[model samples]
Target: MKLLKLTLAVALICLVSCAEKGSRDTAEKETAVTEAPAEKAFKYWTWITADPERTDDSYQEEFAKYKDNGLDAVLINTNTDPELLGRLTPLARKAGLEVHAWLMAMNRPGDSVALQHPDWYAVSREGKSCFDHRPYVDYYQWLCPTRKASRNHVLGLVEGLAKVEGVASVHLDYIRFSDIFLPIGLLPKYDLEQEEELPEFDFCYCDVCVAEFEKIHHKNPREMENPALDIEWKQFRLNKIRAVVNDAYEIAHKHGKILTAAVFPYPEMADHMVRQRWDKWDIDVVLPMIYHNFYNEEIDWIGFATKQGVQDLKYKDTELHTGVYVPEMSPSEIKEAVQLAKENGAKGVSFFDGPALTDDMLQAIKETKEGR
Candidate 1:
């Protein structure tokens, strides 16, 4: 009887203990769920070109203005100059700013590597290579993403920049095929209708890409009646670029650095235009070039584009920073754009460049920074 009584008493104690433990666990989970997440930080960044005058002293002078205006980072097109990066790192850090290596990945303008391997340049559907005949822009010399040599050449540049001391991140630009469909505003200037996919602008029909596509589907892309409508072929090109970008992401993460890209405003439209499926690219952050004027869009389009990118990345870990072109925009217009970006869930905002910005534009950016 004593043993039975003792067993019942122990079971009762255990029941009470388990109930208390369960209540505590529920309370803890409730606290965790209700606790507010840390506020997202607002960052300001701008792009700069490293001209001959951008020496150590000049760099210091340039960074001082950025620091004074509450800028947090600067993306500089430093090429593969480790020496210059070595010099600029401490200076930028001293000025309370971070330096990101701005690199042109697929678009290698005057690239000595591409110059040597002329076959590495992407060929249009019309059998024209970017090497001999430049695309819409004289400098739009794009490399074929499927070629092993092209991948190695670009990755070598990225790896070198990653090894640079104090480079906060490697910002990739022009990491897409030449635009198959130019923006509507640009079409008039280029004298293109582009109601349908034009053979001249469509690209990446180089020997390697052709052979691979044929091997996959047992068909040639060039023979397709409407190559643009060939979803499999289009996905092939998208995957090729995605592979290169993923390799870059791995390289950056392996060295403990962030990998970012300057992408087109909308993923679906970007896919149709540039074959840049950046939504699938494994990147830490993306700065969509949400330049309204380029797209012939209004100021409010900034919010819409930013919101679209945010929604696309809602399931991913990537952060979005909207890139604003400040050339033709007024100070008030710029402020409104920044507000739109913030309201639409942008973590930060980046201006297209530093050299083009005037005092008024800078003051407007300052106003945005001060929350005025």
Candidate 2:
């Protein structure tokens, strides 16, 4: 009877041990599946500037809010203030969040380098410099990409930002021409009907651009009755922007930094309105600002725009991140946006600015992180 009892106890112990081993094996397999190749983890990030946050002593507390909210990264505009960045980067790293330096590439308002060379300013079809005329927006002081000085100046700024330690990436913003054709929804605010491209908004007809176009086509674009109808003239401007972006990409790569841009949502629309052919840019990541309200689009349009960008980048090595404006979104809407972005092959979702991160939005983001 004693031997039988001992045998039964040993059998029970072996059975439990085997069960535990099987559970571990199952867990390992599950982990392997979750970490499978080509399967990227979703990245949730936000954009902020260092002016008040970095200068004040409350930056640590401000950064803590982002870390606690399950944010994978933060894109901060240091305003090219290296000392401010140097101070803020370590704080972000300590909180386990990646930090990116957001810098304006072509749109330099009151930029001393550009101010010194007035000819570097982009020109309108009506012979106006964006510097003096200040079209549409007062801060639309865009530099001409056709000039060697302009390219060199942008590259120098990129190099400075990329070399800063703890900066995981460098974000390029406002890298395109001014909105020649505002989004249909926004045209009303400007009190303009964009049924036709107006000369007042058409851009970059500077001396360098005109001379280059004439040199290639053996004709002056300014003399054309309707330059907007000319594809070659548009392509010329697109190529100039692309050249500056590619050069900046090379500079970022030289410093072993990732290059990313916040571009218009729809590639075709962007090309037509702003001459931003972002699809051709050779960068690591592209964040298309899928702000539906700005375009008078429905929530479903986010998925459509995201899918288009994903399709455009299918063959390329670039990753797509859908950028949403927080003011127009609710917590439920935020969750829906993330789901749609993932459904359309987007690797992640980003918000335009940080202040708009409300409690409900943070809750939705938390649920997203938990796979809820």
Candidate 3:
């Protein structure tokens, strides 16, 4: 009986000790989960055009306003003037905002050097040059990416911007071909209906592009009955734009800067509309202008577009930042836009223009950043 009692006591003690060990294990797991790190905050940015005449103090004040309201970066369009960019970069940095040198890549209007060589401009399928016969607008003077001289000129500008001290990245805008199909919502404003590929809007049938395409494919795009149906012709233009971007990428990296661009909504849409396959290009970041209102889409469309771009870029290291048009957005709508961008996997959000953001909009942006 004494031996049996001793054995039972030992068993009871073992059972209690095991129970306590199990409880400690569960507590450790819970503690580990509670101590896990939180997700990183989303970045905010805005596009601003710099005026050389503006005083440095004014720019300091402007940049401070953006930084105070939660903007992490500013893309400044100085018309590809590196000197002006050099002057503004320190000001923005002093205000605690990253400065990006924005340049009009291919669509250079009133460019003194390019204007000197009229043949450098892209020609439409209708045999009209963008230099003399402006397409859609007077400022749509896109240079031929296929031409050695024209492409080099554009790259030189990129190099200039990349060399600017304190600049984060060389931001490229209008880097694609002229739009083959304007957005549906913009059609009414132009009083037009584009059911198919129109000749007037089709581009880069210039001598240089035509010769290069013919040399490689042994066919002439100009002689084809339906050039749009020719896969090689379409791919040729896409490759030309890609080559320019890839070259610019190398140039930017060589100068210790990254390459970023303001692209269309998504890869397929950008390809169909502007012959820009941004997903295939070698770029660091792409801020797709997902202006839903421009396409007659509702605010929720922002999420869909952002998700589409994110999915397309899943295999790439390129970061996608959703660019929203803020001129027409109300304060509530702005909040929803930012949240949609975040929920849809965008790394950040950028307003179209800095001057268009109102106080209420800035407040909305700030509150969203703070999770209020």
The digit string of per-residue lDDT tens for model 2 on 119-218 reads 8898888899988998888888988888888878988998898988988888999989988888778878878877887787888888888998999988
Compared to the true structure, candidate 3 yields what TM-score? 0.90
Q: Find the 10 residues in a row with the least total lDDT in model 2.
A: 51-60
Prediction 1 TM-score vs. true: 0.90
Ranking by lDDT: 3, 1, 2
Candidate 3 per-residue C-alpha lDDT over 1-372 given as tens digits, one digit per residue, 9 for 90 to 100: 999999999999999999999999999999999998976568899999999999999999999999999999999999999999999999999999988999899999999999999999999999999999998888889999999999999999999999998998999999999999998889998888999999999998999999999999999999998999998999999999999999999999999999999999999999999999999999999999999999999999999999999999999999999999999999999999999999999999999999999999999999998997
lDDT score for residue 182 of model 1: 87
For all the candidates, what are their Cα RMSDs to the real structure? 3.8, 7.5, 4.2
Candidate achieving higher lDDT, 1 or 2: 1
**RMSD of model 2, in Å?**
7.5
The global C-alpha lDDT for each of the candidates, from Candidate 1 onward, is 0.89, 0.87, 0.95
Model 2 misplaced stretches (Cα beyond 4 Å):
1-38, 52-57
Worst 10 residues of 3 by lDDT: 34-43
User: Once superposed on the true structure, which residue ranges of model 1 sit more than 4 Å away at CA?
Assistant: 1-37
Candidate 1: residue pairs that collide: none
TM-score against native, each model? 0.90, 0.89, 0.90
